[model samples]
Target: MADASAGRAGAAEEAGPSIRTLLLLAIPALLIGIASAVVLWLLDLVSGWLESAIWDGLPHAIGITSDNPWWILVVLTFTGFAVGLVVWLVPGHGGPDSATTGLSSPPPPIGTLPSIGIVVLISLAGGVSLGPENPIIAINGALAVAAFARFATKIPPLLIITLATSGTIGALFGTPVAAALVLTGTVAAVRNGGSLWDKLFLPVAAAAAGAETMHLLGGQTIAFHLPPYGTPNPIDFLTGLLVAAFSAGIGILAAFLFPYLHAGFHALRHPVLLTTAGGLLLGLLGIVGGPITLFKGLEQTGELLAHPGDYSAGMLAVFVIVKVVALLVAASSGFRGGRVFPAVFIGVAIGLLGHAVIPGIPLGLAVACGALGIVLVETRDGWIALFLGVALTGDLTLLSTLCVIVLPVWLLVTKAPHFEIEPKHGLARPPTALA
Candidate 1:
C-alpha cells in the first residue's frame, strides 16, 4: 500500500500541474489577460486619436483634402522619415526589423518597448499598411514577463510567454477561440504528460479574460454581416477550393518576393532613406489604388464589404494587388507591424473579385475561403486560418465546407516559402551607413 501510494504520487507529479496548481495559475492568468487587453485598448485609443489628428484634423486644417495624391505622398514620406528617426536615434531601434519577426517571436528587451510602441503608433497613424498585432504582442509579452519576473518569481518564463501571447491574441481578435486555435500547434508540439486541454488551461483562461475585456471595452469585431452560408453544395466546394487555392498561390508569390524586397530595401543602407523610399513607393501605390488600399485594412475591409456593389471586378483586382504590394513594402522597409490584417484585406478583395466574376458562388463562402488560404500561407497555422475564415463570416455552417476546402489549400501552400524574412545577422541589425 505504501509503495502503490508513492507510485501514484510520482505519476501524478509527472502528469503535469495538479488541479490545485492549475487553479492557482488561473488567477494570475486572468489578471494577465485583463492587463493585456488594457494595453491593446490603450494603444488603439492613442493611435486612433493620432490617426484622426493627422488624417482628419490636419487635412481639414490644410487647404487640400486628405485623399489628395500629393497630400498622401507628403504624409507617407513624412511618416517614413519620422519612423526612421525613431529607429535611427531611439534606443533599441524599435525592436528589430519587423520583416524578420513573427507574431510570437521572443519578446525584445523590456527597455525597447517604448521605441517599439512609438514606431508602431507612427506606422499605424501614418497609413502604413501593417497592423498593430505584432508589436503589441511583443510589447505585452515583454511587460508580462517583466511583471512576472518582479512579482511572481516562481512563474516560468515560457508560461508567462504563453499567457501573454494568448491574452493579446484574444484581445486582438475579440475572442478567446482565436487564441486557442492559434496556439493549438504550439501546445500540441510539447511532449509533456498532460491532456491537450490540460496543457491549454492557463493560456485559455488568459485568452478568455483578454477577449472578454476587449469586448467590454467595445473593441471592433472582425466579422462582417454578410449573407449567411446556409447549405454547402457540390459546386460550392469546387468554387471554395478554387478561391482558396488561388489566394494561396498569390500569397506564395508574395512570399517568394518578400526576401528580395527586404534585401533591396536594406541595400539603401540607412533607415531613414530606406523607409522614406518605401513610403514614396507606398504613396505612388496609394495614388493608383486610392486611400482604400492604404492602412492596416480592417476598417477598409468593412467598407469594401459594406458597399461591394460599388466596385467592379477590375477594381477589386486592383485592391488586392495594391494592398499586397503595400503590405510587402511596409513590412520590408523597417515598419513595425503584422501581416495578418493586411492579408485579411487582400483575401477579402480576392473573394469579392471571385464573386463578381462568378455570381454563382456565395459571397460568404468565397470570402471565407479567400481569407483561409491567405492566412494559412502567412501564418502557416491551419487552425487559425480556419478560425479566421469562419469568424470573418460568423457562420458555423461553412465550417464543414471550409474544412474540406482547406485541405487542398493546405496542399497548395504547404510547400511554399513562408511569408517571413530570415535576417542574415542577428535580428536584422540597423544598417551602418547613415546616408
Candidate 2:
C-alpha cells in the first residue's frame, strides 16, 4: 500500500512542472535588481583599485588616467593588437558582433560569458573610454536566462527578460525612471511591434523599484525644483535653440560615423590590434584635447559643468569637436561602451560657448543647463536628457530653464530624417521573430 502511493507521486512529479515552478523562477526578479546594484557598486570599487595600480605602478604609461594624446597613437595601436590577439586566442573571439549585426536577438548568449567578463574587466581596469552599463545589462540578462533554464514548465521568455532587465535598470540608475526608460526603449527597439501599454509595465515597476532600492541603500533620489511659472528670457530661449540644434548635429554625425568606423576596424579582424590601436589613439587625443575628453565622460562632465570658468570659447569649441571624434573612434574600434556621458560632455562645451557671451549665469550653471538642453534635442527623450544634464551638475532648480530650450530644439531635430537611421543588421526576416 505504501509502495503504491510512492509510485503514483513519482509519476505526477515526472509528468510536468507545477505552476509553482514558474513562480519560483520568476521570484528571483527582486534578487536580479539587488544583483544589478551590486555589480555597479563593485565596478566602481574595482575601478578605483585598478586605477591606483596603473597610476602608481605604470607611471611611464601615457595618460595613466586621461587617454594621453602624445602617445595616443601608440596606445590605440597596442589596444588594437591586444584586441585582435584576444579574438584569435579567446574562447568567444567573435563576441556578440552587435555593431553591424545589430542588437543580439537575445540580450546575450550563454556561450559569450567568458569573453564578456574579459572585455569588461580589462576595459574598466585599463581606464578605457567606456561605460560598464551596456555590458552589465547584457551579462545580467544572460545570467538570468541561464538560471531560468532549469524550470520544467513552459515559462514565457518575455516575462523573464522583462524581470531580469528591470532588476539592473532599478539598481544602476538609482532612479528607476532613467533606467526603465532606457532599458525599456532598448528592449522594445530590439523586439519588433510590441504595443505601447505592454512595454510600459516593466519600466514602471523597475522605476519604482529603483527609487525604493536607492532608499534602501541610502542613495540620493533625483528631482526637479523649478523657478516660478513664467516664460524664460527671450535670449535664453534663442540661445538654447542655437545650442540644442548645434549639439544634436554633432550627435547625428556621430551616429553616422559609427558604422563606417566599425567597418574600418573590422577590416583588421584582429581584436588585440584593434583595441590597442584604439587605446593609443585615445591617449594621443587626451594629450591633444588636454585629458578633458578622455575616459568615459562621467567625472569629466561634472568638473566641466561645475567649473565653466576654466575654459575659453576657443577651447570649448575644440573640446566638443575632439570629444565627438574620440567617441566615434573608441566605439568603432571594437572597444565596448555607452554614449550618454560623451553626449553630455559635448553639450556642456556648447553651453560654455554661450557663457562666453553671457558670463553672469555662473559658468557651472550655464554649462549644466545647456548640456541638458542639447542632449534633449539629440536623444529626443526629454526626461533622460533632463535627468542626465541636470543630474550631472548636482542641481534641479534649472529644469524650468531646460523646458525653455529643450522642446524647441527637439522639435527642430524631429523633422530631420538623419535623427533615426535604419538599423544596420537587417530587420526581422520571418514574421515570427518573437518565437
TM-score each candidate.
Answer: 0.96, 0.75
Question: For model 2, what is the error of residue 175's alpha carbon versus the real structure, in angstroms, after optimal superposition?
Answer: 0.8
Report the lDDT tens digits of candidate 1 across residue range 248-271. Answer: 999999999999999999999898
Alpha-carbon local distance difference test for all models: 0.90, 0.59
Q: Across residues 238-354, which tens digit of lDDT does each residue of candidate 2 receive?
A: 565565566667676666666677778768766676767677777677667866676666667656755666878888888888787786776677765455556677777777787
265, model 2: CA deviation in Å? Answer: 2.4
Please state the error at residue 357 of candidate 1 in Å.
0.8
lDDT of 1: 0.90
Number of the top lDDT candidate? 1
Q: Identify the runs in model 1 with alpha carbons over 4 angstroms from their true place.
A: 1-14, 426-435
Candidate that scores best on TM-score: 1
Q: Which pairs clash in model 1?
A: none
